[model samples]
Target: MSVIAILVLDGLPGHHLTTPGLVFGTAAREHPGVAYEVRLCAGPGPLGIGLPAPLPIAVPHGLEDLADADVVLVPGHDGPRAQPPPGVVDALRGAAARGARIGAVGTGVFTLAATGLLDGRRATTGWRHTEELARLHPRIEVDPAGSVVTDGPFLTSAGIFGGMDVCLRLLAQDHGERTAGETSRELLTPLLRHADRVQEDIDRERAGSAGIEPTLRWLKARLHLPLTPADIAAHAGISVSSLNRRFRARAGVSPPRYLLRLRLDRARELLLDTDEPVERVAALSGFTSAASLRRHFSRQTGTTPRAYRARHRPATSPAG
Candidate 1:
């Protein structure tokens, strides 16, 4: 049995409090062999949750409950960048130091970032505050484009149903793809809607960027090419180090990491939109070989290329 502790804070969003339980509960119902205990912990106080109607709630567990948790999750509080109350950050730091996998959903990423555990680690938050998060915590590698980012043991997600994405990822990690896929199918409609909405948000964010937009357009046009960081730097007319710094500051990732993400996104699109063979898809996605594509895809997505294609392809499309 795995114990998952949620640190509830005052002014936390109501959905953020429920999302994890909903996911874990659904997973448990689907997989009886997997047992999980979810505990809501917080410092002693009346915690207020913000929903359409604000409500006051109380939890039985305290910060000590996190001591035994296998995973410590932070929910998004009401404020965009408010620090967690006294003792919360300390407890989170203690949990992380003890090897507990720490995750933050939505603005909760700000709370985790405030603990300094996410310093030098990749994280994302609500689309509205990605720049604010980056400005507040320059040491942390902020990834605005990803729906969910897992770096080391720290996981962060952009707001809205991005929390669901994180939970799906957690389910995949805890059980396997079979269980995660079943659970995903159960929530397919909402998940797809969430993906579309998040993509629109990301697209808007990118469209508003003046400096990085042209470079992004150029890179997207050439995603099929096996381009190196030096190639990108030369094309941008800047040193590799300068390119890295500019990308990290403006786009929230290094050039190579961003390129890899772009290629992966293209590969996913190809897998869904066309009945292309894995080898051909790999070639068009700038992967050197199908083997390499499969390796990286499985590592990043927790599913095989064939499974991903099968799962995502349109119903009218023939199986590849």
Candidate 2:
């Protein structure tokens, strides 16, 4: 069984404390041979969680427990910018030195950054605090766009329910995409939906209007179809040139670029969630052929479809 050490700090949100167990427990229950032991570790103090109604928690495990963990998770807290408690940073550094995969959820990235582990690495926090994180930690390349950013073994996620995304990602890495997808479905959490929501948030911010939302929805619904600029323009009741101008002004990309991104996202989801062949995945995601999917997937993600699947899925597992 993989041991997950969650470093609980004061001012922690309630969900951050619970999400890891919820996700991992579901995975273990649904899939045989997948097990995780989650331990809540903290520095010497009475830990108080910062929820709407604040609650104090008694964490039995101390910082030393971090050394024995396969994965260390840090969740967002209210006082993210504040320095971590005594011995917290050293404990985190020790865990990383010993080869534990560490992850930060939401503002928890600040705590991880405090240890200098995230220095010179790509990371992200809640969109609201991306600017602050970048300003504070100039050494860390803060990506404001990604819902989850993984640089080597250290992973950081955006704010709020980003913890779920991080845990799901951890599950996918440890077990396989099939286990992660099943667990996500069991929890009624769609794996790709959060990414889609993040993209929608970016679109709304760039477009500054709801006018493009309908078009985005239309494009997503018809991702399996060979959609053209003319089809998109007709759907929006505009000429191709007007559609291009509107997409550029509002969505910050041309219609073709935006559609390609959507198709890529769909292809990635299919690759992870299903056992469909590359050719079928390409057709399902609106790519013209397997070669088209391979070219675009490689350009965007830096890996071929088979390599991606092999890297993400366990070799011991049978292919469907």
TM-score of each: 0.69, 0.70
Q: What clash pairs does model 1 have?
A: none
Give the Å error, residue 129, model 1. 0.6
Q: On residues 1-320, what C-alpha lDDT tens digit does candidate 2 reach at each position?
A: 99999999998899899999999999988899999999999999777889756999899999998989999999988788888899999999999999898999888999999999989787888877888999999999886654677767788998677888889988887776777888888886464578789977877686564266677789999998988899998988888898888886775457887888789889888876788888999999999999999988775554587777777754424332
What clash pairs does model 2 have? 126-159
Per-residue alpha-carbon lDDT of candidate 1 for residues 128-201, written as tens digits (9 for 90 to 100)? 78888899999987877757887767878887777778888787777765687788777676767887899788
lDDT of each: 0.81, 0.84
Which portions of model 1 miss their true places by more than 4 Å?
190-224, 228-258, 263-320
Model 1 quality (TM-score): 0.69
Question: What shift in Å separates residue 249 of candidate 1 from its native position after superposition?
Answer: 16
Q: What is the clash count for each candidate, in the order shown?
A: 0, 1
